[model samples]
Target: MTYVLTFLPWIVYAVLPSAHWQWAALAGLVVAVGVIVRQRAAGYRPDALIIECGSAVFFAALAALAFADPDSSLHPYSGALSSGVLALIAGVSLAIRRPFTLGIAKQSTPPQIWDHPVFVRTNTVVTALWTLAFAVTAAVLAVLAHAGQGHSTAATLVQIAGFVAPMLFTKRYVAAVQARSVPQ
Candidate 1:
């Protein structure tokens, strides 16, 4: 799903070894930029690339920092910072009344139903779940980083679960809403 693809850079960053954090940051920047270019070339509107754009900005800055000072103190807490940034982005999207999921969903959903109450509600709820997930993941990762276990298996598992749980919720929630709207 396009929604999942938006997180590919984050996934890349998470899986790579922290000993080579600069490389990981560079890789994330490259992947984020590539995803944005690919989606744009495929005719996706800017609105549909909210996460992609945010990712590009985040990764570019991170890469610059990592390269400029490879031994920066921020390196150890990059995971928590990443999740915190994501939470900020998602939270701001909701605050502005434009859940990022709405744009991604529009790619598959018919335009006729784009303005439907159920459709809007679905995106809102899904985005809220994602925001909560990111926030919680940030908190957990912060604790781990403080304990000097930022790159521990527990942190990695938490990151994976954070994305997976919200993804599953989005899929099932959308399906259930669609089913409810169907005529008996």
Candidate 2:
């Protein structure tokens, strides 16, 4: 579990750079489901499931966008978002003050992401903000659609997926921190 948690951020970093905007989110969704199933099979409680799934899906989408350009061009919003996501990861790590020991899952740890009030509150607030961002973006899409504006709906979808990546990855970050304090 520890190794998996640690590598998730790296996975996001890798995937976002290579995927097209149109497919980043879809790819993220797939990644999230895969991780959730894996975590459940490993005997994680429901709390763990939420954190694991949310982060994986989020990171996958974000990753698809982050590395959208092989040259790592900053032209794309995905790249920008990816940067923000990385910053968030770093910030969370610093706050936790743990050097991040990987492979805690090998011991089959319990889900305790919500045990710390501060973490739980911060994560929840971030998730809520993410929801609001999604809503606003949806509104923008609806207006654009009504005005018959924009070239590719596919592209829009991909960008939206990129936005979701942060939220998902954020959740994963929270869960990983919680997992650190949880007993096996």
Candidate 3:
């Protein structure tokens, strides 16, 4: 899925040791570009353009920073920074009245319902949940990074739970709403 692909680089960066972080960052950039190319080739707008673009920018910035000062102290906070970027993207999407999830949701949604208030409202709520998740994840990661435990198992679990919780909620919430809408 697009979401999985988008997070591939982050996962790589997280799993790799600190010494190999530069390589991990580069790998993430490569994956992001590849995902964009593949999605475009399929005549589909990539599901998470904002996230992908943000990743590319982050990677590029990190690459430059590495080149400028290989020993920069900021390197350890990469995970927190990544989560913060995600939070920004989600918040901006909501502010612009174009929830990032709307595009992904539209891929499977019928054209007739695209303009429905319920459909729009559903995506808005889903987007808000995602925004909250990213914000909380960013905050937690920041705390972990400050404590010099960003790469600890506990931090990893928190990050995974942050994403998975909203994802599971979205599925269940949507299903429940749909079921309720259908006549008995």
Best model number under TM-score: 1
For candidate 1, what is the total of clashing residue pairs?
0
- List, residue by residue over 64-164, the lDDT tens digit for candidate 3: 77667766787767777877888888889899998887877776777799788888898899889988998899899889979988778878888788778
Residue 143: error of model 2 in Å?
Answer: 1.6
- Clashes in predicted model 3: 0
Model 2 residue runs over 4 Å out of place are: 1-35, 48-113, 149-184
TM-score of each: 0.97, 0.36, 0.90
**Ten-residue stretch with the least lDDT total in model 3:** 42-51
Could you tell me which residue pairs clash in candidate 3? none
Who wins the lDDT comparison?
1
In terms of lDDT, model 2 sits at: 0.47
On lDDT, who's better, 2 or 3?
Answer: 3
What is the Cα-based lDDT of residue 69 in candidate 1?
A: 96
RMSD, each candidate, Å?
0.8, 12.2, 1.8
| Model 2: per-residue Cα lDDT over 119-141, one tens digit each | 54555555444444444444554
lDDT string for model 1 (5-117, tens) is 89999999999999899899899999999999999998888878888889999999999999999999998799999999999999999999999999899888889998999
